[model samples]
Target: MDTLSFNHTALTAPNRTVEVGGRRLAYRRFGHGPNLVLCVRFRGTMDSWDPLFLDLLARDFTVNVFDYSGLGLSTGKPSYVKTDMAQDVDDLVTALGLGKVAIAGWSIGGIAAQVFAALHPEKVSHVLAIGTMPPGLMVKPSAPLFLQTAFKPENGIEDQYILFFEPDSARSRAAGDASVARIASRSMVVDAITPPAVMIQSVIESADPTTPFPDPDGRYQAFYRSTDIPVLALSGDHDIMFPVENWYAMNDLWPTLFVVTWPDSGHGPQHQYPELSADLIASFVKNNPRPV
Candidate 1:
């Protein structure tokens, strides 16, 4: 296929579907080169990602964005459990016949990415997490304002800035506006809004203090401490939902992990610095090619 024939962009990419594990999943595949499956955050569809970020990533990778089961255009029972969400990634990769693809996730989606990496190591080449917390107890819990604003029936531009970027920082707020505009350019449909009941379930799961992701026996923590899979997590210093400081607390554990934090920023660093983030991703993958 001629690359020029298709735009391979967030707005222009065609929606595709595939049957897996008795249900159909909705997805879009754009860009070129190795496969990169991205998981969306809570209350988010594949459509919510920043356009500039996707376009920049398309330069070196064939980005695959998908809705979890029963979300967006998909058809099946819905779940917000992080491990179950990771299972969606596994099943989709198997159905697509992709080999050793990089798994990227944002916010709660990043939790699923970490789960996928730890449990299904052979299926993943690397893990890219944006605006998310690492597994286990947080060094600092999420701000109450995050839950208050994030679950609103509708989030205005200001809410977006607070939830995803730094409203206090003029530059971050401007970047938020640009990203919101880019996202708004896409055609909107009613099906994209996750149901309220499901959102509630997600909220509950997100707050569960004893999530088995850490596992009582210490296996998952050990994986982070000693896995060969290269991991990269990006965040803004004051992320209301998942603070960057949590990653800092784990400094001694992850030998192969790299955390990038932007000053005076918030949750959505990729949206704020799309081009630089993409460059970092490409460089990370190039420098740490997964064992073939």
Candidate 2:
């Protein structure tokens, strides 16, 4: 589901840019109904989102995808901040004029979602967090050490793609590299080194999530306790970043949550199994409609 294949003439290209935290945010939207905003994992862009999964989701809810400042079509490099990125979520919500919206995030973006929902529970309807941890990982290093190396830019972004994909077999790695490269090349049009740095900063900051806004100690708990919003915690059966154990720990902390696993998938279940992920989201939204 590459963007190139889309008939640009047929669909209206979403309006881009609105001031959010003094940074120009880049966002694209499709379909219409209840708004759905997808926050990318550390260092990801709207184009990096799986096209197949989005096409499936567009069948039901309106989907809005964007990048954090210093990444993708967004602006500001020196001003990039993790807490600011979290605030960008709310700003975009207001910019879009969405009264209430579902917030879904992956990896560090999940932490951003937690902060966003915590601060503005009234604006968020449901949160779908995929492949993320509660706060600290020094206590729970479920991920393999090799996985840490994957995040390092010296190893190259291709290595991270290999780590995130399912089966991750020799064949999978080869295919994923080719696939990731093509997509990244199209969306990341600006300077070569900038996008990677935006991602690195996000990771370095989140390494100590406790220092950031909303505070780490019981932060996830606070979000769960404070918000009436229903959450769907989804992770891959083979997720290496935030392992299945991390998900269990999170679920144990919040009993009301429902957990779903993609048995054949890895860190990126949505990419590996877009249809299934979309179905899970669609079902959750249907069963747990937000109040007006």
Candidate 3:
């Protein structure tokens, strides 16, 4: 299949690194609407965000995406503890001077979003959590077996998306899956060639799970009871990382929570349905403007 290119107005946003809790973190901005910050999942970079999705959201909101410390362009090695990353997010919010912004996260990014909202509800107007579970990894399974194996630590990131992208399909998922595979494979080779200790340290740090990790379930339950802010939780019916059941649990905790399930997608509704995602998000923002 051939690739098609669409032309549109583009902005080359600048990158900035700021000190957050004694560590440097990198970030970038684009689009032009109310401030919208997107935090990627574990080990994700700004590049991990789908360009098309960002462009669409940018049409309606000023979208900010960045690498947490130890990921992508950010400083330090990867750390699993969500609290540290949450602090990085807090610092990013301060560094960008984005006051009371709508915060969104994917996968583990959602966990960080939860932490940020719980810790600084005053600074967050709304929360959008996608493909994520509550704090303790207590979310139960709804994804298939193949996907479970795909996300395991040993499974090469190169094959991560195949579980949902449908390699046989001729759509963008297949193409994107291939692209990610190539990039991840190359990344693995680089890690293999470089000093393994540095990368290992990052991975170990990420594994610490200091922010609500050991007991995310109980903590999220408490956060739900405590938070008054509106939340929009989106999940893919096929997501292996965090399944639809997690969303159900969240709804049980926060009955008023706005929930959307992309029946045809897994883990990445933004990629599977960019227009729908953008429209829903824009409408969410319009309906729930910040208090004056």
Strongest candidate by TM-score: 1
Candidate 1: regions farther than 4 A off: 1-7, 188-191, 205-214
Q: What tens-digit string does per-residue lDDT give for candidate 3 at 22-72?
A: 777776666776788888865466666666677888887777777776665
* lDDT of residue 133 for candidate 1: 85
lDDT score at residue 8, model 3, on the 0-100 scale: 26
Off by over 4 Å in 2: 1-15, 77-82, 136-139, 142-147, 152-161, 167-195, 205-216
Give the C-alpha lDDT of model 1: 0.84
Structure candidate 2, residue pairs in collision? none
lDDT of 2 by residue, 221-267 (tens): 66675456888888877676776676677666664567887775567
Cα RMSDs of all predictions? 2.3, 4.6, 6.4
Per-residue lDDT tens digits for candidate 1, residues 139-197, read 88889899899878778999998899999989999889999998888873223667766
Global lDDT scores for all candidate models: 0.84, 0.67, 0.67
By lDDT, rank the candidates, best first.
1, 2, 3
Q: C-alpha displacement of 249 in model 2, angstroms?
A: 2.2
Q: Candidate 3: where are CA atoms >4 Å away? A: 1-11, 136-139, 142-158, 163-201, 208-213, 290-292
